[model samples]
Target: MHQDPTENIVEILLSKSTVKQKAYRNVCRAFKELEQEAQLLIDVISAKTTERDQDIKLSVEPVSDQEFHIRIAGDLLVFVLHTNIISLPEDYEYNKSNYVADQPLRKYLGQINVYNFMADSFEFNRLNDPGYLLARLLINSENYFIVEGERQIGFMFKSISAKPLDKVDLDILIKLIISQAADNDLVVPPFPNIRKITVREKLEKTQSLGAGNKIGFQMSYQNETKS
Candidate 1:
């Protein structure tokens, strides 16, 4: 019988041995596959939603987080997530500037519910929409982040998951997390910047993007040793 890889993952974590490394590699491999699936999904969904672009009239600068802040040419749109969620820095401001009093980053980043999005949508829509599915890169991976076009948008995980402790905390929680064994299916490698490769590896392999925009992140993997 095929056991859940997550069980193997937890055991590997619990056991300090070479098997753990192999398990970690397996986890990364799994995330990489999921990431690809997510991209395909974006392409498919975007094609369907393009026809409704009458209200979408903002410059797409291909900004960080794969998000682009829209001026709407000439109109006022009080922005919020698909949910009755409040605004984040990325949700508003024309550029990347903190908005919540002195908090700087206090944006709400909700998951991109594909099921809900297909049913409901913001009147004005474009590539860099204000939902999870719109902004996150490596969505199914641990390195996943809430992509935002505007700095006005705060971190999204804070509300759905919990509040950020600091920049460090902000960074950690933003990406994919392992709440349980199944979540390991999406957990990214090295957990953080720590890695089998160095920062240079990241710069070389990864396309760096700004605060709210997204750049692709290819999770790394080690080969499982054959017994």
Candidate 2:
């Protein structure tokens, strides 16, 4: 366990290439608001004391009274990056819900399941993530209310209170995600719902438009303040 929890997170998310890294990056980018709302602790302890693994798991228990439950699991070569911890060693085979006896493929299936368990957390996190500004703008338009012909359908849309998320916004919330991908490329996974989906399309849009490394206004301001 690293002395500073965020440092352990940063090390694993930024340096490690194992399976768990992807989920960690998403949690960081998508759940930054939770940095304030939730208490995040870094703990290293044995699991299977054993429905899961002899590995690492991220255990997410809700507060005394709350709206969410988040847990991420770790495997032999990976550390769970969410709330509940689940780590099992290799060569120990049980009936995974998505099992086909292909361990690597099956592991990912389980990984994705563990990934989805906290879907609500990520969705709530989305109201604060990048594309969310756009989603919110759409929601807020007086035009935000759309009437197709006679029946009310959905909301119409307009624009941001500002110029919309430009390069800097993309850098802070979007590319930071891409920079940590396994292939080191910005991408969107195939899941359709924003909550279920990884922000790969946003990655493509930013890269295509020539957005790359940059800093957030908040971080930049802090740096200047220090200097």
Give the C-alpha miss distance for residue 97 in model 1, angstroms: 47
Candidate 2: count of backbone clashes, pairs at least 3 residues apart or interchain: 22
TM-score of each prediction: 0.22, 0.16
Displacement of the residue 56 alpha carbon in candidate 1, Å: 6.0
lDDT by residue (tens digit), candidate 1, 1-227: 97679988877555533333333343344333333343443354446656776454332122223122222223111212232222333433311332223332223223221111210123333323323222322111122223332121223332121221233433332222211111212222343443356676556534321212212232222111111
Worst ten in a row by lDDT for model 2: 218-227
Badly placed stretches (over 4 Å) of model 2 are 1-46, 49-55, 68-200, 204-227
> Whole-model Cα lDDT per candidate?
0.29, 0.25
